[model samples]
Target: MERVAQTGSTNADLLARLAGGEHVGEGHWLVADRQTAGRGRLGRGWNDGQGNFMGSTVVHLTAGDPSPATLALVAGVALAKAVTAMAPGLDARLKWPNDLLVDGAKCAGILMERTGNAVVIGIGVNLVAAPELPDRPTAALAAKGAVLDRDRFAEALAIAMVDILWTWRQEGVDSIVRAWLPQGHPVGTPLRVSEQGIDGSFDGLAPDGALRLRRADGEVMLIHAGDVELRRPVEGN
Candidate 1:
């Protein structure tokens, strides 16, 4: 694997270069010490400083392709595995879609961009503790005792991701779901999920991957996709 490490924004620059006809292929990555215009899920902005693991990998898919959701899961799973391997005693878990959490704190987040038959996976992990966001309960890796070497971690992640991707491709979604279950957060407990317009509330993670929450009128609603904020049980809170 090869890496292009720079001092500035990686995601923005990669997209720019890619638009300019630079054909980046698999096994190559565009890494940045700081992403001035870093992005996150749900169109949130990230203010990544130096001393963080912020980068993106370019993965090329075959011309005829399936949905890219599996790749996203594989990337998250591979990253969780690598982080656990790098830091023993780190009980890393996967928050569905693409977040790696250790001891209930976020250690990594992945963003995938698809163009035609290729996908560029952008991963941002905080090696050092990040500043607090009053609006959410998100977290960083250093808060979970995971301070890693960027280059080494990136290499391990890429290789492991390739393996995970291969397995998911061969065995299909069931295999991926089975592997994801053990690491999943406990079910039947209230999970704080984003409400359509107002603040979200506690619910449980459904078996088929939707977030199950009771509405104001005692109706149970299944959320397809949105950010989730795992909260402590009312007694615990």
Candidate 2:
């Protein structure tokens, strides 16, 4: 683990280190106290909340490994386990492609970037404070009555990730998918695909770990990529 008081972005830093021929072994993590130029999925700015968990780790791919895309599911399961353990009875849940939600409000997010044979997994958790956003609601562990130190949470997350990665490599994507399903929104939960503006119900994940969305016409669509949001009913609905 490498700690810094602040940086532009942990993901960018790690990728640069790798490109410079530095050996960033698997399981090594680069943690930042604050990231000035952090980014999330869809190129959105990632808010830097003091005392939050902001870090990136790398996974070197090999010929025998499962599809690289499925690592999102692996990360989700690991993160869900770590957060659940720390915040007992917090009602934490996961969204497809690795978003962590507490009581339907997002509390954390994961981003994966590939460079050559290495995949960098960056994660951020709102441990001490949550940022208000225009698109959806957000939550923090402190506000939810699950106060935890950033370093302690990082340690727990690291351990959980190592164990889950083992399961991913030893068992398969099937094992990771099975572990992930029960920790996510229950089947029949309403969801929306942001880009396509198409709404559907959560139909679980496909065999290869893609999201399965059941449409209104009873057609099941496998979503490979998109911004998926839980669709809450309108005020008068």
Candidate 3:
């Protein structure tokens, strides 16, 4: 793997380098020590401290393969497995598409961008605790009593990604779906789906990864894509 290590923001540097024709080949790693311009899902700015982990890897998929959820699934399964191995007692749960959480708080998030058959999978995991984060709830591995050095820990994570991605390529998304279902967001449980125009939609997880919303009129709607933040079912609904 070709590793490009940066002392500051990795993503912004990556975008600049990518824009400048720096060949980001498959299996290349871009790591950051402190991300001044770190980004979370939905273009939100996320900053990481010196000790936390933030990185991106490039993956090449076969041409015309339109598994829209591919990078998210790989990131989800790989991150969950890595955290599980690191702290045996800390059970990891997956939020559909691209989040890994522990005890109802986000521990890691994946942001993917695609260019033809190449995908850039950006990942952020807090190796230590962070404070005053936006969103409903968030967490770091250290906050949950797990700690790891940014580099060695990232190597293990990359290895896990290799195996999972191989399985995904050989088999299908079902490979991950089957593995993730049992580790999935609670089916039939309530969620808050957030989007620009359509927010505040209460929902649950459908079998095919669609968000199922239960509205005020007692109607259930299927949402194909949106930001799903977990929430409790309102009382007396």
Candidate 4:
């Protein structure tokens, strides 16, 4: 665990270190108080709230490891567990891939990058304050009355990751998927796939963790990648 007052982007910094032949061990985390160049999935800017949790961790992959992409699920389950543990009954849930939500509002997100034999997973949480997102509603632990200490949350997250990661590697992706299903948005929830320009209902996740989207035609599509959003009912509908 390492804490820095400021940095451009913890994920970028850690990736650079790894590319420069530095050994970034698993379980080691690089957390920044403020990330000037923080980013979310699809190159979106990640808002840097002062008291939020912004950090990156590396996972070294070896032969026989499950798909690297499934790490997103591992990270999601770990994050959801950590937050729910700290603030019990907070209604924390995970949106597919790796977005954390509380009562249908996003509160945190995860980004993963692969290089050589390692994957760097970056995460940001709205702990004390939530950023104003143009497309989605946001929430914060403190605003919701959780009032967590940033440092304490970081420690809890790290511990949770260790346990979940082990399960992912030892018990297989199926185990992670089972643990994740109950923590995620309930099946049959309406959703829209931004990339595919299609709408569907959440059917659940595939065995390997790909999203299972049940289309209007009653056909189930296995979406390997896409920007998924909860399809909210329009007013006056």
Candidate 5:
């Protein structure tokens, strides 16, 4: 673990280091107290307030391991576990693809980038405060009465990620899927997926980690990529 007062983006910095032939071995982490150009999936800006958890880890794919894409599930499960452990009795759910939700609001997000045999997984969690997001609700651990510092949270997250990634390499994607499902919303929860222009109930996750969307016409669509939003239940349904 390497801690810095600030950085442009942990993922970008680590990628630059890798490009320059730096040996960022697996389980190595880079954490920043502040990020000026942090990013999320689909080119969205990730806001990182001071004292929040802004860190990245290096993962090297081994033989017989799943695709690099499946790292998203690995990250989500590790984050969910870490946060729940920090804030006991809180409902920490894994939003499909790679977001952590607390009480239906996003509290953290994961971003993964691949370079050759290495994958840099960046994670940002709102520990001290939540930024104002225009499209969706957001929350912070402090707001939920959990008093944890960035270093403490980062330490826990790093340990959880290391343990889970080992499982992914040893047991395969089925083991990860089994562990993630219980931390996520139940099957059949209504969802609105923006990428495919489909609004359907959550079917489940496919064997390869693609999202399963059960449409109204009884068609089960396997979506490889998309933005997922939990739908509000209709009154008196």
Candidate 6:
């Protein structure tokens, strides 16, 4: 584990280190107190304020393990568990692909990048503060009454991730899906998937990590990539 006062991005820093021939073995983590150029999925910039949690982990995949894509779900499950453990009585749920939600607001996000046989999983959580997002609502652990510090939360997250990664490596995607299902929105929840430009009801996650979307026409679409939003009902419907 390594903690820095500030950096452009933990993921970027680690990637650069790996490119520079730095040996970042599995379970090694890099955390930043603040990030000037942090990023989320789809090239969106992440806000890494002083009180937030910004970190990345190095994972080297071995043969016979599930695809790297499944790491998002693995990270999500671990994060939900860590946050809930830190803030007892707080209900932390996961949004598909990789986002953590409290109530209905986003409190954390996960991003994974692969280099050779190694992958860096970047996670950012709103510990003491949540940033203002343009399209979605955001919340912080403190605002939700958790009041955890960045270092403490980072520590908890790292531990949780280590355990979950072990499960994923030993078992398979089935185990990961089983662990994730309970922490995610229930099957049949209404959703609007932005990338596919489709609105559908949430079916469930496929064993291999694909999101199963049940469309209005009775077609079940397996979406591999998309931004998901809980569909709001019509006022009078």
Tell me the whole-model lDDT of each prediction, alpha carbons only: 0.67, 0.93, 0.72, 0.94, 0.90, 0.90
Candidate 1 residue pairs in backbone clash: 190-203, 191-203
Per-residue CA lDDT of model 2 for 5-91, tens digit only, reads: 999999999999989999899888899999999999999888898899999999999989999999999999989999999888899
TM-score of each: 0.80, 0.98, 0.83, 0.98, 0.96, 0.96
- Model 2 — which ten-residue stretch has the worst lDDT? 228-237
Clashing pairs in 5: none
Q: For model 4, how does the per-residue alpha-carbon lDDT over 41-135 read when each residue is reduced to its tens digit? A: 99999988899999999999988889999999999999999999999979898999889998899999999998899899999999988889899
- Order candidates by lDDT, high to low: 4, 2, 5, 6, 3, 1
- Stretches > 4 Å off in candidate 4: none
Q: Write the number of the candidate with greater lDDT, choosing between 1 and 3.
A: 3
Candidate 4 structure, TM-score to reference: 0.98
**What TM-score does candidate 1 reach?**
0.80
The TM-score, computed over Cα atoms with residue i paired to residue i, of candidate 2 is: 0.98
Q: Kindly list the per-residue Cα lDDT of model 3 for residues 1-237, writing each as its tens digit.
A: 434445455655555566677777766678877677778878876657778888988777775443756557667888888878778788678887688878888877888876655677888887796645655677878878887877887888888888888777777666766766666666654566666334334344455545567765767887777787776556894
Top model by lDDT, which number?
4
- Cα lDDT of model 6 by residue, 71-92, tens digit: 9999999999898888878878
> Candidate 4: how many backbone clashes?
0
Question: Candidate 6 — which residues are off by over 4 angstroms?
Answer: none
Assess the local accuracy of residue 72 in candidate 3 as a C-alpha lDDT between 0 and 100.
Answer: 78
Q: Name the regions of candidate 5 deviating beyond 4 angstroms.
A: 233-237
